[model samples]
Target chain A: MSLQESGPSLAVVGVTGAVGQEFLSVLSDRDFPYRSIKMLASRRSAGKHLTFQGRDYLVEEIAPDSFDGVDIALFSAGGSISKEFGPIAVEKGGIVVDNSSAFRMDEGVPLVIPEVNPEAVAGIRAGSGKGALIANPNCSTIICLMAATPLHRHAKVVRMVVSTYQAASGAGAAAMEELVLQTREVLEGKPPTCNIFKQQYAFNLFSHNAPVMSNGYNEEEMKLVKETRKIWNDKDVKVTATCIRVPVMRAHAESVNLQFEKPLDEEKAKEILKKAPGVVVIDDRAANRFPTPLEVSNKDDVAVGRIRRDVSQDGHTGLDIFVCGDQIRKGAALNAVQIAEMLL
Target chain B: MSLQESGPSLAVVGVTGAVGQEFLSVLSDRDFPYRSIKMLASRRSAGKHLTFQGRDYLVEEIAPDSFDGVDIALFSAGGSISKEFGPIAVEKGGIVVDNSSAFRMDEGVPLVIPEVNPEAVAGIRAGSGKGALIANPNCSTIICLMAATPLHRHAKVVRMVVSTYQAASGAGAAAMEELVLQTREVLEGKPPTCNIFKQQYAFNLFSHNAPVMSNGYNEEEMKLVKETRKIWNDKDVKVTATCIRVPVMRAHAESVNLQFEKPLDEEKAKEILKKAPGVVVIDDRAANRFPTPLEVSNKDDVAVGRIRRDVSQDGHTGLDIFVCGDQIRKGAALNAVQIAEMLL
Candidate 1:
């Protein structure tokens, strides 16, 4: 359990994905403890070699026996694959850190963000050998709650209404390529086709986060609602989201309207956010300084700005803030690796 | 009011702006009957020529005497110019349709949208040139209420929460150029500058729409609240808006959550929207056919989709709908021209 000592070996599943590539890069950049590294993915990706830490390793097709000698496994494959193979990896004595939403809300599993809840990582029971599958919250949820959670400690977070401008990377590598290609086509005087998304992805914006449920809310919207509650541990924290996909390449930007139980001011909000673990506050409106997707795309920390007092509701104090984070970094890979770092 | 019979002439203020150019284009394309067209702008843009209807008209410097021989003047200029010259035009016996927020909520001035409130156009009372100014609603309000006003006829619209993906065109010509330049810089492997917006507009989204008010809401949010009430002729519609600027060019997208006094269904919503003038419902999820920015750009009607029942609250039906319309067209110029058409 000591990261100080040379730590146990690590395995990264789906190492070719946007998030998976970020995981490998973050691990090497952060110099996270590991005696050895293993790359795993589907059969088609097997035998493909990736270079990390000046060493070349071949990817092996993920199977039930893939985690036999591995100490920790990082998962970024699709949800169905994670749902089917996650418990099996756990069964083979590998502690699984899943980036998918498969077991996030399970009664027995622990959803962990090391910065917010490192103690939660210890709840992974040892004897279960279905080694603990630690769930990582969604990208948007992690970026938002990182700023809001610290404020909630001083005052209760009553409700949050978020509108997200998500990047193409969140949809995976091919979709990102589609965005780039479609944009190139549009610039070249051609109409971009709709294949990866319901609408055109070049120079366009639409509501394609997830399919809307029978409740008139899309799956992506519901995830922001449900995951925020799970992360903040407050079901009464009302959350409403209108998630949209924009033509951005990397960072996911969210405009969060939060109503607090107590009054919050600029000084207090800045003071709290500046001290928060993974938050950076950049609120200078006169010079027009605030976080944008390009500024936070490759960074580890969540960039926040436009932090000011809510003038609409007089009696019930509120704070209006904007947050941007690398969906592939803190939103996905860096967070998963951070959770693993906590356990080590 | 007769198209064939001309009194004096017509003038267009702010003729070089995004909405202004669109006004010129729509007028020419629709064969609007203007005996003569006087183009006006600031002293800097004076002496330029705007080609319309197979004729080139020299732009004049905006001043008090600019509307001397003008019978009808359409103002799509900023608030300051509208406030300064709208009355001047009205003083010269011109029926002024101001596309700015200057006279929108004035006590005696009428706010008109031809489709939703044609009665308002007819309701223009006989008065001196002093009270001749007519107000146009905000872009977001015009788009949202166009889709929702029909529903309100069948069910009371109790509350509405909207999240807008506004295009660069809403912020004027500089913003549009900023988006294009910033995007080009990003594609060329350079860090773009942030001037027109608070953040980098290339592949970045920021939530500072209309200035941020003291109460946490931005001017854009408050405008939606105030404009919707005035447009619907209801003082108690209960509107909440979170407006964010995305990296799109012309059309603005809105995700609306509405709660009605009575139960609503997807089929009924679809029917009402289809029959409503200036609205097109493209709600075939199975075929992946929904309204998108590219599809609705340069079009007059508001395109709506993602309609369903709200499963979260019992007896309180919910709907998720998207609206995309060219902010310059239906949101500004065409709407004003359509109001003039109703007057005729």
Candidate 2:
């Protein structure tokens, strides 16, 4: 299909989800080229009406036939749902861009971050399935690797030890509400019930929220470790992560220590990160200025700061940087929409 | 001295400060033996009356002679005051347990974390001008080493990567208040300002609060690196840490990944951790139960769970443990008082 001739048709699966909603907003804001829009969800949300670009559309129950006339499909539902129905959506002639981890590590599938590896998507149509499935990086990894990948181009990343300060949005809409409810409950002098989380999410922090694997890494931490390696396509890159959930609602923050294969001066490191795409440099030590979740929440650009050398090593050429990005937008929704836009 | 015999009096310096007040509470709660009690502070807080042991004591200005009859003096005011008056307190025949980092890392002085290395206090004596300056470990290090040291006893320690979810109390009382005030401002639709912290302390989490050294490790992160080695007394211990402040108040939590010289099995690791003193085993994965800040905030014992093996590395045992203990108690004041108990 020529860009000037037939416009693309987009289908949003899991239209009622947090990321699904972002897909709608990004398509509208970015003016993605689309002839028709179809919204699909679970049977419970089917028949619900939503409007995009001033046009009303009905949310239909997701089925094999849902993507018949669709050119692209965005999936942000759980992994089980994606696993059960992703191939069916692709079989119906729609290229699927899945946000879940279902097909992320599959050797045949392409795991992509548009800014990092756009060339990987060129062969999306030359696959065994009807359409290719592109995996979106995990929320924390997407936020950190966006800033790290640009720096990695200048210096080969030897290893990264990341500790994430994640927001409730990474867990989902229910976890977000749990934070609010738990906060209010604590304020009202009532005991907080650990429903959405294993512990109280009000005025508290936990090292692990997702189920911990036998590897001593929680689901969240493992996501950061694996997804970053896949997106950067550097399997030998050593990445260790500790993911923690804080009481924040939106932006996710990561403290990253990157050891370079060769010495890179602190000044050159800062300069490289400053000119990086989709990154805002905010390193002012005298003014106590640095990238923070409070500043980056709801913002599009990933904020990077605290650029300095790592002192523990004798040679001391390694740099430490902190990155913060909105978990909802750039991390999930906006990234998925950008993938679809690549095809357009 | 017998229990009924008169002993030299003890002084609590900086009684109004965060750690100072906690020392006062710990002294009484633990029933430390003292002939008399003297509460001391700066000029601003002097003359205020504080009650301990059902008796009121006057807060006096910290002077060179304030340690006249003080056999044991606990100091937490700041580094400068400790540097200026620590020797004077020692000259007056007082054993000083200094909580500040002033004398820590000094070749002559010993940094004591009672749980890790109580024998470090054996050097405390009255005759030397050294004044028995026992240093307390940094909060993050205190929490991390508490969990790892027990594991190290069974397996030789080699490398450790820890990510800290630190509480505002680790900063000071003002930082705690700033988190509360800024959170209220954010909820009320007002843009919160960074006052006590470098950025908004409310509804946010960020990594680089302490000065990031030229080595890429922030002051907070370096504390974890240096202090962990000191407390464990193993310079060969390779430690990499990322310290982050979350929207939490009192308890400091850590996610630790430790590599042992000898690989460990899960059952043996659990058995060792279960019998470890000051450590509570809460690893019940089936019921989704684990140690949490809400359960350990006011407690002295460090709560640990998620004991498992490292799937990422071969022949390296990994345990995903979440540890939480009151920063004000175990991390600072109570720890200093515990060191004092060793002296008496």
Candidate 3:
């Protein structure tokens, strides 16, 4: 029986990693069509077993031949792994949707947010016989732009200042476990086990662990800056970001200040965001309820609140917003799956 | 025995609250001279016993006559308690160093940050046989200004943007206990206990619990904006803030962006902060170490790091920095004690 009879054959690289596992969950949740599936991971996890949609699968070591017959490949391993295997998968006639920073800034590779810039992957399809590479923006950038873009379209955003309260899940599943273990140890009057991070991760927060660039912006913060420019396709838009890792499990919250080229009042900006797709408004001034990381822990939609005019700016020229989104879902797995769906 | 033999007689109001306890600790730590001391609280804690400097003391119920013959009083109860009793203490000839927001914006009260604006209370002395009131700025404002004021002095900051990651101690002792309990409960696969806050606060964060105003800025946020102007004595300075409550125990972290009228490079800003009193520089780019709340938990000096030129602005006219300071130490009790020390 031909695997392509009902739908495309699929391969999931880094199937044992955090986002890799999430990719499978998102695919199953979305009921993505697949005739046959291959689970690929590093040599250490090659013999592991995983079940998806009541079907059992044995993980295989990733090799050059892994993508030989694959139609669409989802890559979520670290950047170095993606760097080594991404091109090979494409060369093997598999369309690659990568969740690493490997080729996000590559000139010819289209960095896409399906909700914001679906047209970036205009003609690429699973059955087109031509293999293509699509890069997923960084999680902070994806979560920020998901809320900022709808308003950016209504009034051109000239500058944006973002401060992120990121979650442990952005680091990986192991880091989330480390946080829990550390919290338990600290509560018991024992020194916390600091395996995933160098310092204490429970009941504490710190700057992002990404390496600091020469300009003093960490890799994580610069990703927000550069990815916003690329995804919006507007090089003139200016951005600055301060990324912090909080102790939350899986969701991220950002405080964004936007300076626009045109006047956009708070009421009008709220109206625009209300009609925007994939965005939920939780702003209730009377109830004092706004979007929070815990409230959006496992949700797919990005929540935006604290909508108000920037009092420091000239009348109606700037707005301040708070946003929360599940880092592993909309920020990573769900975003990549949406890109693959566009290809179908 | 005359109680005024060595120094002024002192009174500590709200002696059972978190900041109130910190007040006693700081006074003892500083070897503050006091001939007589009174521990006063509400009726709920009237019979409570507290030990200070190896001496046992009973908490007395606060009354209008509680301030009689008292040379200085430190108030940290809620706003209404301070509003009703603060002037009463002053009327009884005791100088009041208030840690509440009751008189922060009053026309005659001098809002003081000892490190930044000690001169505002030059003439108010504890033993002048005259009563006075001094206001301590909010914790978020105190932490932000500790780092920003030095740069603002050199380059004349025209606009400032701040985002805060606050701790549970700002809500009081019960809130801190609630956070610990909720964390333990959540780890045990049970619903978290939600008492101090309406939502789960373990491994999660939310916007500040301050009442949201009509303009969409919460009271905690407005305090930062308004207090900066009052403390700096700069009515024209533009300030905006977003206040968030993180799961941290005691320290508050702030990300501040400054736009200055004069050009100030990152190096110069670093030099200025290095010489600024009550501020420490922790900007180690190679080690990827910046200020974190855990590192600053009980520290008296505010830690500043992540200092960089704002790429979004032109030619050294703007910069960004991250700051962390203990909410109870430098933010509240320590600041009030410093104000009282100035009166000596």
Candidate 4:
């Protein structure tokens, strides 16, 4: 693949979504070249006027012919919409980079976290006559793997246990608005409006709003387990997760425990993460300043900290790490954009 | 030891603090019999009026002579106060069940979780003309152990990993008030008050405010590790923890992973915990309702749920459990009062 002098035509699906908005911010920040861009949304949001990079654009209702001239389409409209439109976009001669879990686990579709598994998306690029679909890994998976894959590459991870502190943005733009509204209502001694979540979300956390599976793990957690195996391309690796919906507004935080097949010393593990691209090491013992959701809310880089030897394992056969990354940016839009950049 | 018909004299030190206030609630709710009671506090809280059990009482400043006729003292004053005053109460012929971490790891001082290790305070009684100090484990340790010990007894845990989602009450009464105030301020677009914690506690979670240790683990995390070994009476058990303080108000929750020396099937483990003392099983996958901080607030029993086999571990050698308990009640005051009841 080689960089082209002129970029391909791009389309932003679900332009009114939280992640969709971030796509524009990140595109503007990076100056991602695009010959033409289109904004597409649902019928209700279609006529809305949105300005991007100092130019006005109107959202068009997504149709069967929406991808007719689009060289690349970034989709974050819920899973159902992605499941329907993703294949249509690809079949219509447009490469689709999806943020939903639609085609993530399909055998033929590539689930790419560019920093962790760039090679999986090889031989695919924008403007190619044959269009294809590439899936973006879940937010929690992207943040955890951003720090873990560097160490996993050095010492193979045999098992992983993850606990996430997620924010409202994972649910979407209305959920974020609800969190703000609910907090204010709760503060004013009124009943909080529970539209998105069943239970109260102000100053509380619950199991991820994702429906629980019969196996007792929610879909959000299973995504970490299954997606890590696919992205790392190592099926023998074991993973379990307990996902919680915290009260934060945007960034997601995770406490990850890793057991390796081979010994990876803590200092060496820290050195590997420090040099890994797209990751910033924040392990400072003296300041007691590690990664917080508020610290990484709008940041592009996923922050890694609390790098220490797991006391449960003798010597350094295990390591524990804490990570934080913007839920909508790196976890969604920026990652899809990164995959698209690789396509060019 | 037989239960005494007429209970001994009881005194509550630091009666103005959060845990101190809960001491009165638990005592009155349980109908704990006491021949006489005294309210003790620092000079600042002295001369203040407090009513308990429909009787008005004045808070008295603690002096060396305060415990002359007192048979039992429930102390929740800070560690330094406990260090200076614990021995004085014991020397003045009163049994002290200290809530601070002062005497927890001492050679003869017993760390008691009434449900898990009641026998640790054996043969000690109020009004016996002799006194002894029994320590209450940290809130996180108590909640984790209340659920883990039942399974540990059946399978003999070899290694454990813990991650805590603690509440503001763990820091004390002022901290809880600050959380409410900070939430309102942040919701109004004003800077949050950061008096109790260094970072924002409104809609954010942070690594515990406890001091960081030399090994990069904070004091709160180490307390879970060391206290578990002491309470379980197994020094060889390997333990690691990452403690985080969430924005919740009262209850503390923990995600605990246990590796056992013997195989314990998930169904059998659930049955055992269903019958365990101080534990209530909430593992209903159908309802998708596991333990939440709000549900467990002001509740006596520790709520345990999300029990499942660790898919990472082969067969049944490992298990994962999530638990929540009242941080101020069972974690501190209720546990102290339970120890006092045993002293009778």
Candidate 5:
């Protein structure tokens, strides 16, 4: 295929992984304009062939020279790889939108969820003379803030309690495959294969496999607590989360309880969310219909439902909601692509 | 088989149901003394045979006269059946331990968890020649309070927020078989059967199927809210809950956040739960192991783990815990059987 040679050149890091493949899907789905595109991966996958945008491209192993002429780079490799190559790509004059935790909390890097904090990357653009780094928020954090930010803007949230039903996709492709294999093995009356996770992931759920921090909160839960503070630019807003991995495939569901500084009735909150971008309201009290992970598996918008007043809180100062979103779409790849689009 | 004639005459209501069969298992396991036992069910199941304590007995249809000379009766039938037969059993001089929601919130009927509030049934005995009624708490409530009450007793919890991951068994044996069948059908690339629940239950989760009240909380969630206040005899305690149904078979998991009036550190809370009856702590931070539903499938003790100080609250005035217990065993049949043991 011949290149159009009319837009900024792009590079996709970790081109063979789950979120990496999703980046391509989202880019093509949105008809993203690119003059040229480079497929980059680890040394083991360097010679593999991938089809993107009706063009056959050979994957090149990531190296310093890989980003020499790139204008925008989307990185979804693990933290160690991003820690080593994210800066190198930036130093080579490419705007790096990293989908790893390596630079999320760093002061210099802007943690961007385009819908919530697009202004964080204000002066940075593609085809610019200078290089920059923009970090993508964690999958859980992105999905949560998609529904929470609009409400927070209205009543000024004071405290939030979240309980997550996370999917296997958050752990990447291997873990998702393991869940399927384990489910089949369990059904066949054989022992489930227990790779990727230490315990059974077959008809059962467990606390997230993330390393537990010293304070008894797993690293995944701490990401929700810390990233919400950074993304909202409000350190005083209290957040606590309990993250559990269910047997679902590729979407995450959350039960969120919000306490605001001022009164916000459920009706007004629903109106605000219905107008918010990248959010869909599925609250149907009459039909008893609400958001489910399967309903949002491959969709872009986050679905919010179960909108009601928190009876435990005084009057109307509190509201509770249930939200579900595709972990790989809106949570990771689509959000990162949206940030890259703002640069155009 | 001949009657023992050494203890109270017993009657088991709804003997063909899930919890009904479990009631017999728990009775035999504890070697509960019964001079004579009657297996009673609806007319459709009459003449069926049920084996208990190595003796086979014919199931009888429940009627007003079925409770004649019956010292105690355990009821696992639905609310309507219980409402119809409970008063009849009581009028016939039988002490009734009903597992339905028919009389949980009644004025004079005592809702009992043998470990939490045995004294509420004070002066009520099996052979007292007078009949009485007792109600069993909901499964989720029984599992959550089993862990929370110990800490609440020490620090005096003022508010509670709970989110549940409930199993299929809470619906019935038919629902459990449906889950297994739906799982197999889904794996075979066929559509899942959605009979017991309106939504697919193979690898998905949804909000509880309990009817939503005018206040927007479902009956299951409200049960937690109202039962806590009643069980603790504290009208001022505030509680909120979000109940969800997951795909597990016979156990439920709950994530609980509690705010207390007095300061209680995590270490002290652990110490208290360690000594508390019907509670087990499985917190192993280094191993990243916590309470999982599969681990407590048929166990009597409710397992508690992921114990930590709530950083959202200041100075140990709050705590977070995860709990799991068998929905059929400790949550229903075992609990009712324990209440019957108290009568003896």
Candidate 6:
């Protein structure tokens, strides 16, 4: 049979999750090939009917036998769920592309951002008669590197300092709902209900809700620091970040400062970004318009703008750029599907 | 008359404006000594009545002769009004402590942040029978310098990078109200009302509404850069900033990266900030609590937290810090009032 007619069997673990639902949209948008598909979620979300590319499927509760006869499984459940089911799926003869943080740093598992480091998962493919696991980076890290990696390839980034204005969608769909509800209540002169977050999330911004590590950086910030080093394969590359959760809905905006070993002028940098794949330059200084979260909420390409020389660094060795991308798509589902596409 | 019985006669310009109203509250909170006070606004607000220090005063229209008997004039109307009236107030033999950007960069005009550079306006008193202009630095500059100056004094900052999360209050009282109104409208499935700001600000954040300069940095970002140099009296210091307006109410938070000429450990930096005047340290990593805009709203002190060594720089020459201060209090009115208090 032709490759198109005999595509690999697929299963979507955590089919009812935020990113999991997005995986279906991205898959349909790209018209990814799959011979057969199964839906899996927790017992609470089981039996839920979901439509994917005009086919109806009922999500079944995740179990040891769920991956039987499946060739590829996309997992977007929480970290604990991924840890419990990822190895089991691989043992059942299926490749797992996990959207959780469970196996991202595992030595044997390949952490990939298809556009940045596709070679990391070169030999891992569906229908190879062998099972393997590939890890998708954190949402913020995926969004940030989509812009920085191209620049890094040119200037050899020696150090990076990032400050993020993340959106509520990074937490989950439930958190986004709470943000809207809390905002409405606060506007009506009522006290806000803080459930997903410890503090008020309406009309105010705060540090990311991730647990703080002993080094004073939260887990989200550390993810950016550690993930960048591993993905770039540079153990000595220095990184620091401060991640904040703003009141935006779906996209995240970041202010990035880069110190490079080679000089990169603003004009050259702008030219490079304009030509880089998966990057849209929105640097319109005359119009006073730059990359904003609202403009890139549901967009696919990561927008880069406000490109300028870092006045703080002497010479042309430093540059600053602002970026924005959809947290659910480019940050999670879209990236995972792109890796799966390469597998075919 | 004894100095205690009769103090400087003060005039509050733009008495009907938000910062103008805040001037009254801060003055009363501190029980600032004054021989008498005048409430001055435009002809539009000439008939408005304002109560301060248990006394109700009618707002008066400003004219050339309004400063004839005034010892010190606190100006907060706008740039145009300050440009026309600041010099007139000074020419009328009164010290003009301006809260506008009109004279912040002028030669011989002192841009003072009491916590950072009280010496900038040294030996200038309101009752000296001579006119002078003591400029109140921009609100963001005052808040950032309050934290950076303490660390700079010890290590001598050579370069600084700042990313600001500003609030709606910086735009004015109407902007704050508009943010709340727009958020409510958007939540109810209605298009947001874009009166004060040109874009939707309810569930969104954007680059500062300040006009973007030719260098790709907005006017607000430039204010942070230029004002820091003038306040610190360090023309050699390099600074760059990206300022964005978040949906918070009255306080602003900033993430600052500082590169020092001398090596200052994080412990010593924390100790210095704890003792620094007008600064409160809130670094509690265990609780995942850091300085936030809500906690610092309407408060006088600039809260500094998240103090850590910048891993990007070696030899302890770099540090990262987060700071929050009431945009109306420490940023504008309180800083102006404190500058005026030095005249006592």
Best by lDDT: 3
lDDT of 5 by residue, B232-300 (tens): 999899899999998898999999999999999999999999999999999999999999999999899
Candidate that would win on DockQ: 3
Taking all chains together, the TM-score of candidate 6 against the true structure is: 0.97
Clashes (candidate 2): 6
- What is the RMSD of candidate 2? 3.3
Error of 2 at A179 (Å): 0.9
Clashing pairs in 3: none
Model 6 chain B — which ten-residue stretch has the worst lDDT? Answer: B1-10
DockQ for model 3 equals 0.89
lDDT of 5 at B258: 93
Evaluate all candidate structures by whole-model CA lDDT and list the values in order: 0.80, 0.78, 0.93, 0.89, 0.92, 0.89
Tens-digit per-residue lDDT, B124-199, candidate 3: 8888888998898999999999999999889899999899999999999999999999999999989998888999
Supply candidate 5's per-residue lDDT for B301: 94
Question: Model 4, residue A35: displacement in angstroms?
Answer: 1.1
Return the DockQ of model 6. Answer: 0.75
What does DockQ come to for candidate 2?
0.42
Question: Chain A alone, TM-score for each of the models?
Answer: 0.95, 0.94, 0.98, 0.97, 0.98, 0.98
Query: Model 6, range A62-105, lDDT digits (tens) per residue?
Result: 99999888898999988999999999999987899999999998
Residue-level lDDT of model 2, residues B1-344, one tens digit each, is 21224554678878898888888778767777777777888899998988777777889999988888677888888888889888888877788888888888888678887888988878675334345567777777777777788889888778776767788887888888888778767766897877888667777776747875655567888888888777777887888776778888888877776678887876788898888877888887655567767678767888888676654445546554667888898888878888887875
lDDT of 3 by residue, A80-187 (tens): 888998999898778999999999999989999888999899988896778889999999999999999999999999999999999999999999999999999999
Model 3: residues >4 Å from true position, as ranges? A1-4, B1-4
Clashing pairs in 5: none
Where model 2 places Cα greater than 4 Å from the true spot, the runs are: A1-5, A125-130, A151-155, A314-319, B1-8, B123-131, B214-216, B262-267, B317-321
State the C-alpha RMSD over the true interface residues for candidate 1, after superposing those residues: 3.2
